[model samples]
Target: TVESRAIGPNMTACHHSYGRPDLLVYCCPPGFEKSVPFVDFELPEPPSPVKVRRPAHLLDESFIVKYNKALSIMKSLPYDDPRSFARQAELHCQFCTGAYEQLNYSDTPVNIHRTWLFFPWHRMMIYFHERILGSLIGDDSFALPFWAWDIPESMPMPDYYVDENSAFFHTERDFSHFPPRVADLDYTTDQNHPHRSNDEQIDVNLKFMYTQMVSGARKTELFMGCTYRANDGYCDTTGTVEHAPHNTLHTWLGSSLNPGREDMGKFYSAAKDPIFYAHHSNIDRLWEAWRKINNRRLDITDPDWLDSFFFFYDENLKLVKIKVRDVLDITKLGYSFEEVDHPWLNHRP
Candidate 1:
């Protein structure tokens, strides 16, 4: 079993309802000062003609090539460099593995997954990551791709990630899930559902999407999750969708062969894989689609939800603190998900 280090003065103890042991996380670690020495409070100006990220399956050869090049460069940088692949992956570890404390509530750890911080915190993480990747390749308008795994036609891992030579390729993934093989979104490590035919699988997938994305998320709290306040103990309530498809996909992608399932199955190592970003892009896209369902089904407008904040290092290596309010608009952030068909809207199981 994986165990976190002892809880320190700067850590927060987490409580869960899943019968798991309490977890202690580092919300902010010591010595890793939160800012770029030269930069002030605000982040540097974003590049003009902001990129419109599209589905990984739909990307052309040139974009794929450039994308790999950018990743390769990122991976080759020094481990100490904040923008390096190792350092970038550590950011995920820092937040998820208990490396930092909640700013004012240092004794209370920061757990972004089960609380309202999941979506916006990750959106900012990926935003800065995308920017850093683009800056490495001198492409101001470059964008990351979303894995359109919800669609039957795009369910398998994108071919770009399977190529052995591609920077996106990670040998740690479950090869049994390689393309032309569809992912089981509702997959569980301990349970097995009898195999279904392709048509049957698509039907199941669509119905599951509808159930998780719509029916299961009818209320604001049910959708965005419970709030985390300063000095609060570990957040135990996870939103419906975040608990379902979002968590399901993570376990589904982790290679069973690797102990602790580094890079995908576990939170601390998930970001180590390039495909993790695309996987999350899809999750982020679902958040966008959910809000557009109707006037009644919108994001939580709670003041506590909007005012919550998280910190991250920007492309320029500047540590910036952003609020949930700042990212409610993706357009203002200068990026958007490529439009795609929502086949699950009417697939009411």
Candidate 2:
């Protein structure tokens, strides 16, 4: 059976079709970096302008009603609602199609900048989507949560995520104990057939980011994973963990996908999937936690970093573009979350 399991909210690896046993194992690009041992990132809390109440996980039964309402509208949608899923899909189609056409297809090695921008842009996109969910659930305090991947053992899998009956619970699948390489791989250009194995490789890149450790280019590979060693379509087969890299549904979407397998931190092709918001929310939560661990990591403080963007839709199904600057002030959007009591902050290893 195929394991089309989800990673974290809205994102799942669809690796069953390639004759691979699981999507969990991906091939390494050239110059594969050592895997960083998964470590629990903990830190003192950072003060926020907004009152940080309990986390979103502790929301009550009523929240589920709103969650389902918003989610249903996002996917299947309501019969009377003007802003339905069909409208959203239609708008995206016109926008993406028009955008793709304006570019020069005649150029060799034509890459889509839109594809590159999709992940971060979608981050904000889903942020709003979840907000609608929160509003519908009647708890402005809600935020879509994520699946914590850095923990060492028994990380959750898809089988346990969705249960129409249950009120709230997480799945099971530990990243730390994930399968390692089954046999020695011949690090050659001809190495093609891909499979996965489990090992005890320690990741040096994560150590650098979470801890104040130092790592060089090898650290890059460590940050990404095995996909670094495998030959990317690009000849620059330098091995290192990459971020915002691969598009899981690029073939299905027939669009250009990013090349990454690093921390799943930055951008990912999986965001197009409806659950992208939840996976990223977990990622964003970790970012919040990391900021507390180390002050420097706080929300995009870079001057020229282009950290913000916008997303909206029009009546005629045209994709509306928003800038990062406008939405940065989340408070002005007229929403606040009621603190969660038992957030999955991963206090226990």
Top candidate, metric TM-score = 1
Worst 10 residues of 2 by lDDT: 5-14
Write candidate 1's Cα lDDT for 131-190 as tens digits: 999999998798999999888789888999989988988977788778887878787777
In candidate 2, what are the lDDT values of residues 1-349, reduced to their tens digit? 5322111110111111111123223221112133222222111123323322223334355645555556664555552332454433332332222211111221112111232223334445555455455555455555565433333221222222345343222122113321331111111113483332323212221232233111222232232222110112212222221221122212212112222222121122233333334444543443334334444332343322232232343222233444434344435533233332222232221
RMSD in angstroms, candidate 2?
15.2
lDDT scores in order: 0.75, 0.31
TM-score to true structure, per model:
0.88, 0.43
Clashes of 1: 9
**Model 1: residues with Cα > 4 Å off, grouped in runs:** 1-30, 33-47
TM for candidate 1 is 0.88
lDDT of 2 at 13: 12
